[model samples]
Target: MVSDLAAAIWMYTVGPWLDHSSKFTRTGTLGGHHLLLLIIALTGFLMLAALAVLTDNFTHSTPMLAIARNVACVISVIALTGLLALILMALLSRLLFGPLRP
Candidate 1:
């Protein structure tokens, strides 16, 4: 959709600007595992959305749509779990790493 494309464009354009200005560093922060998890979770979400759109022509009561939606919902739940784990990990890192010195 146009909204997703525009948001992606905005993030691509502005993400680095925000990161640089914020002096954001991954050191003592999230590790590669966390990043990989986030990427996989996001990929799952996109695939779910694409599946829904691709199957839009099918009748709502069809078994295929039901199966697709159920699968997508399950994948979304997994993605949500991944995101929640990331948040908890980030919080733990903050507690463990302590605040940056002024």
Candidate 2:
């Protein structure tokens, strides 16, 4: 999670702001990096969700197993929702601010 957040910051916030504006004559917009960061962050979040689901095999009792599985199920739902939202944001950002062509 920390790594994902760092990647997000490095790609979107730091990279874009630090880019020399004068280079626009050579390079295009920096929004693509931000979008890529979002995708990576979302992937990490989804991976966490998968890991949570896979943790259900360590139960000591049926009741405890049920509770743990339930919690994992809920976490999975939230993670999937987060992944979907991230994908939507990436698509929208690209639509709104993709690179311009000559």
Best by lDDT: 1
- lDDT agreement with native, every candidate: 0.48, 0.48
Q: How accurate is candidate 1 locally (lDDT)?
A: 0.48
What TM-score do all the candidates reach, one by one? 0.40, 0.31
Error of 2 at 73 (Å): 21
Error of 2 at 30 (Å): 11
- RMSD of every prediction: 7.1, 9.7
> How many residue pairs collide in each prediction?
0, 0
Tens digit per residue, CA lDDT, model 1, 1-102: 233333234334443443344323222112223344344455555765676667773334467767876775665554445334545767888899997675
- Model 2 lowest lDDT segment of ten: 23-32
| Cα TM-score of candidate 1 | 0.40
